[model samples]
Target chain A: MTVAPMLSVSGLAVDYQLSSGALFRKHRSLNAVADVSFDIAPGETLGLVGESGSGKTTVGRAVLRRISAAKGTIVFDGEDITRLKGERLRRLRSRMQIVLQDPYTSLNPRMTVADIIAEPLIVHGLASSAEETRVVVAELLERVGLPRDAADRYPHSFSGGQRQRIGIARALALKPSLIVADEPVSALDVSVRAQVVNLMQDLQRDLDISYLFIAHDLAIVRHISHRVAIMYAGRIVEIAPRAAIYNRPIHPYTEALLSAVPIANPKLQRVRRRIVHPGEAVDIANPPSGCRFHPRCPLATERCRNEAPHLLRKAAEHFAACWNRDA
Target chain B: MTSPLLEIDNLHVCFDTRAGTVQALRGVSLSLAPGETLGIVGESGSGKSVTAQAVMGLIDVPGRISEGEVRWQGRPLAGRNADRDARPVWGKEITMVFQNPMTSLNPLMTVGSQISEVIELHLGLSRPAARRRAAELLSSVGISGAERRLDQYPHEFSGGMRQRVMIAMGIACEPKLLIADEPTTALDVTIQAQILELMAELQEKMGLAIVLITHDLGIVAGLCHRVAVMYAGQIVETGLVDAIFENPLHPYTQGLIRSTPGLDAEEERLTAIEGAPPGLLQPPAGCSFLPRCPIGDKGCEAPQAMRIFETGMVACRKAGVPAWSEAL
Candidate 1:
């Protein structure tokens, strides 16, 4: 009775090569992501929450084959697309799309709305003629709650929220089954952010599309995601269902991140005890030998400092990589 | 409030752009007492930052305070020769912390020089004395290895550490008031919490008053004693943090509260305000939020003024009426 996942990524790792000097030509490889594993079920969102440079965006890019992964397998719809390239990769791109964070710079100012949304269809050869593409573009505009007349205007004429809608319309033009939305609503205003989040949820219900939602804002992630994964340094520290992750997080990093977010209620915020962890995330190139978070963890023991723990099952659907948390 | 420390009376700021005159602030008034934290929460183009800049006498040509005055300790600080008058207390008594620390700190100068410059200029300390005081200030802000870290440039420090250095420089002169505009917006949540904690500790130790301008309601709720909600360059509501959060009288305030998704939100959908804020150029004569107000009626077409209500000051024609009960 369990449906197969739309996208599955296991043991994914990405590395960036850094050249120290032009004369010496000494090269060093920085491991940005390591041993990351997750699955996105059909029509379900897997929210990837992490701070800046935690490799959340690297995971998203690796899944789409935009960047080559140094290790691990990325299976899309039961097909191993880890090494896809040439015509095959071009065809696979039609099945998945991406929406960037900044709407102001994502769209081209010179192109009209119709051209911006229709470029994908034309590039992929999805439609037959200009007339046919126009029909699909109008339908997409309506689907994303924009007027058809907007097709004639440029991106500079639209507001931030409206430009985001245009970007969403362009992403939907390919009828993508999976969307890699990287901080999609982080650059938006507070009131307009909800409208886009609601629209994404509604589209998910109607189209049965899965999403890899990458963001740093936990509250928005909790609102839109069905499953959540907390990442630190370059690994998945914890993964669980939304309620389980928020209510009973097993990893110390997850607990600290949750407690640090300020609540909106004044009365509740006054009495809330914040677990302010010291220092920022470790440098990816020179991570610690044991747990990457041991330096800042309050409950770090000798075992946690010497041995790196593998992800162990804590509940039916909860998994955490910590030596102290017992099942 | 025991003789307000800073009082802004009917402030109006305008910018003369190529297109036309843009009214950035329209008759905005606020009062702050000593050692109090007032949170100014609003979206972009809400004139919150402009109010802070005006209070600091930072507004320049092409954008002038067309009307009203800003008084500091019952002394006029905004008018002709305002800059000459404000120069005495501008940096020594009133300081500011910007959003992005990376851009605010000079890349060429070492962290020690930046902190020492402020101390030497204000406190009349010698070079070596100021440098020693700089290291002490850095340690007070929780930066480890303060002496070594002081010699390093800003590029060597992490984002969180750079922000801490900024705070160290901000408090080097023992300023009486601090104007922070989205101070923690560029930091992560954990680092933001640490910075907010540092600011609170500094306030308690120095008895410093703060004017915090940000777009996040959660930060305001946590750190501020009072809150002012601004919209389209006007103060829609101002009251105690508890009263505003519990029972918001203005429709804009109510909408903002409902729109913000809480950490423990049970509702599936957030109540979004439909339209975007109006353009500043040639804004409507009536309430700026009238077009987006849920319970807007014919009476809202006329300009509304801030009036005292049961809980606080609201600028709505139907402040405490029951008509909004169903609409909200």
Candidate 2:
């Protein structure tokens, strides 16, 4: 018998009211995330890759219910929790947590390391006593490769990488089954970034936690995720296994993003061809009608401009939304 | 071959703090020839930015250039004792572009005026001539409708556009050398490729030498002719980009190569460097990377200098050992 996935989101759409316009005039809403859907199997990582204003972060936030979804449903652990409220939402939060992008701003500067790690436990009432919380926090520190004595120090004393580890320890304090790590290593230095990525993988292996890794970096997402969803202008253009996405991307956007990434090997760097999308940055507020990516897509035709393409099955376990998939 | 456009010999920089002296840069030496691109790769606190700042003569108080000399076309830069404060080489000969375009460009000034002002000051052009030149420069850097966009302020332009303006300003006076420090880190992947491509095109057209400082090895492999690997404020390795990527002699360089996740190939586990960077409050008595290096030993407590290897220079004691081989 097969088990159900940990998280399933369908037709997720999010919008934000424009803050600049006059209050008396008509209100305008920015379509941050349009129709989107995906799933994260238990103990697997699903990377959400996109550029700025592509609604990748909005998808993560909407799933967590931090940001209200204008449309769609989010089902977690085989239960429909789209409109979960009050006690139900609070209860579900323990099973889901977020690791923010910047370690410098994500963590509280004044809080001691121990308190920071214990915040989740205290809020969820997971620990029996204060002493129990301390023990758990100590263990958490050790698991993240931090010294046990570091619990007493403040966040300002630590480096960017160490602080990120502290953030991870706090996220794991509740033993959450799902983690939404949003650009966790982007702020870190290259040398220390590997250590944090390794720690996250190790934690997933030992604890069997699922992760929705959202980032702008293609190489990092490819490394950490089992499956990846490519987002463009608030829509998922493609979803496929890691190998398929990297080696045989069907969508033009995925192909462009993959080719744009600089290969580390000098031999390959000289031979690879870079795809230059001859268009300006995508305007999220006033997006193009029909297919959002039509404006910049090199292979876009009149049919592609007049009609929006839905997710179509390409190969085994691979899906792409493109009018010219075969071409 | 022509003489190098800029050369640094035994560059040493330090910062005096209340607790102790921070040895930010230690005996770092590099040379850039005309139209050559040299990449300086290192993590934070590796002194990449300091080397750029030293070249620009922008190292302020508390941070002093303790020793060594920087030569511009075989002539030493104005040392501590100069009559009046006159920096002739800063904007006219050597210019720099910082990482963050949002803060680097003045928000209050229009993008056109910002570029024009540099040209006006450096080239002694009239206001109208400078503005026209600025518009031309904008178009040269790949910005569309450059004339209309020149009048707009920095906030009106996107991140990528603002970086283009920065590059245009850096090369406004036709500087021989440009020090771009993490120039494309803030932009997205697609936009980063565009900016890098634009830089390469400009380099070919104008014969511009660039000192590209970044932590990304992939970028170095893609763009740079030569590579310099910095660790603990010192250059641990230096070679051609191909040599450094293919046969990295220093352990740190090898670790960096293995640690970075490659888009072409997927690995089960990354080879992460174990420990944190050493504190810069005081220079270590031995190899600063000894604690974290995989092949380090007790003998590493003594100082080591760069040794000439077949392909390049390596500063580690057991740099070229075969035992460290076969790991990749």
Candidate 3:
């Protein structure tokens, strides 16, 4: 018997309507994310790795229902929340929380730490009185490794790592089954970044919460994620177990991305042959006819350029979308 | 060693803010040889950028280089008359590429004109000649259809392309030194590789010395010949990149390396430094990293100075001791 996925997204697509200030010009829509799919098991992390404009963040927002999906269905637990509306959507939101990229801007400056964490509890009607909310806030602060006295202080007093911890505490106040953490440690210092990443990992083990860890840093993703998905031009080119994605990436884009990451050791970095993929990511507004990455892919053939490849299983629990997977 | 191209001696920079005087840099010293690449690795508020600014004479009002001498090719470059003396060499000999290319390039001006402006100002070239050189420079940085793209504004370019444009302008006058302050921090990994490759190519072609200031250790290891690890306002360690990575004497450097998640390393819990960097306004008296150092003791309470090691210089009391290696 297989355990059910806590969150499942299928054929997810997000479109942004572009407005040209002309009287009779036709309205244009940019498909930010197209045909993306993934699943996050309870207590598992699905690292979504991509460059800028790859729609990784869009996938996270669409998963959280913060942004309406243009196409596809998002199933939370056993229910299809693709078209969840009104009170039903608000209630479902508590089960799914979002941790934004920049902690400095995510939290309100005027609100105290207790108020920030308690706001979610109060909104969900989980806490009865002010005393109850305070107790829960203190517990959350401790869980995130922040001191209990930190509950009374404002966001301005906390460091970047501490501020991120507060954000995590807020996300956890609702006992969310899944948290869409979009570049959670990108803005933090290197030393502080590790602390936050470790804290997030610790929380996962303790709470059994699933995380859609969206980040551009491949190494950090490898550390925190049980599985990794490589996205390019708003589509997942590869998805596999952590080792497979890093060690035996089938997709050409994945290989290029892995090679591009600079290793800390000079001896290895000097010896490693980097596969520099020429040209930028394809324009999402007007993508290529078949494969969006064909323009820059080194191993692109006539078939790759003419035919769009869907995710095909290459190994157990390893899937790659490439016509020339063997290459 | 080849008559250092840039030398910063006992540099001390401070910022007078409304709250208090923030000691940004305290007795920071470094020397870089001609055509060498030095990577300044430090976190936010570690004075790496301030050191770059001091060398370039770019420190504005409210922030002053209180104590130190900036020497450019054996000539004093920082003092009361530093600005006027350094003005001539600013773009012609020394150029800087900032972190955010979006804000670094003027949005109003066409990229071609922006590049031309630097060439015209420094090289005394005519408008037409500068424009021609600008297109060539753009092409040199790997931008396709450079002439046509040069006519476009900053907004027309992507983040990576804008950075390329910035690089084109930086090398337009064939500067002897280029200081890139977190140049690739804002770029994607692939794009960052492209930029790093471009910088390396430019350095090889122009024989330009580069001071790459960033928080990422990986980039430094790959690109830089030497590395300097800064904490608070001091250079805790400075050495050959290989030695520093292989055997970091300073506890902070060890912690930083261990904390960074290696791409190839197996999934393991990162060993994070417990506390945050001390506040600059009222920094700790002896060692700023004392609060976070794993092997720090009562000896670390006293002031520490850069001590000579087998491979590099480390500013820690227990640097060469057995306890430091045992702790790691």
List the candidate 2 regions with Cα displacement exceeding 4 Å: B78-86, B322-328
TM-score of each: 0.98, 0.97, 0.97
lDDT of 2 by residue, A1-327 (tens): 167999999988899998765668877888888779899989999999999878888899999999888899999989899999999899999999999989999889999999999998988888899898899999999999999899999998899999999999999998999999999999988778999999999999999999999999889999999999999988999999999999899999899888989978888887889977788768988888788888889888999888889888898889999978852
Report clash pairs, candidate 1.
none
What does candidate 3's lDDT look like per residue over B1-328, in tens digits? 5788888989999999999999999999999998999999989989999999998888888999888888887778885445455568877899999999999999999999999999999999999999999989999999999889988999999898999999889998999999999999999888899999999999998899999999999899889999999999999999999999998888888888888999787646887888899999998989888887767888888889789987889999888443323232
- How good is the docking of model 1, as DockQ? 0.81
Please state how well chain A of candidate 3 matches the true chain A, as a TM-score.
0.98
The complex in candidate 2 yields a DockQ of 0.82
lDDT of 3 by residue, A1-327 (tens): 188999989999899988867868998899898888888898999999999989999899899889999999999998999999999999999999999889999999999999999998888889998888888898999999999999889999999999999999999999999999999999999989999998998899999999999999999999999999999989999999999899898998999999999989999987889887778878788899788889998778998889988888888899899888652
Off by over 4 Å in 3: B80-83, B320-328
Q: Which regions of candidate 1 are displaced past 4 Å?
A: A22-24, B80-83, B321-328
For the record, the alpha-carbon RMSD of candidate 3 to the native fold, in angstroms, is 1.7
lDDT of 2 at B87: 66
CAPRI-style grade of the A/B interface in model 1: high
Separate DockQ for every predicted complex: 0.81, 0.82, 0.83
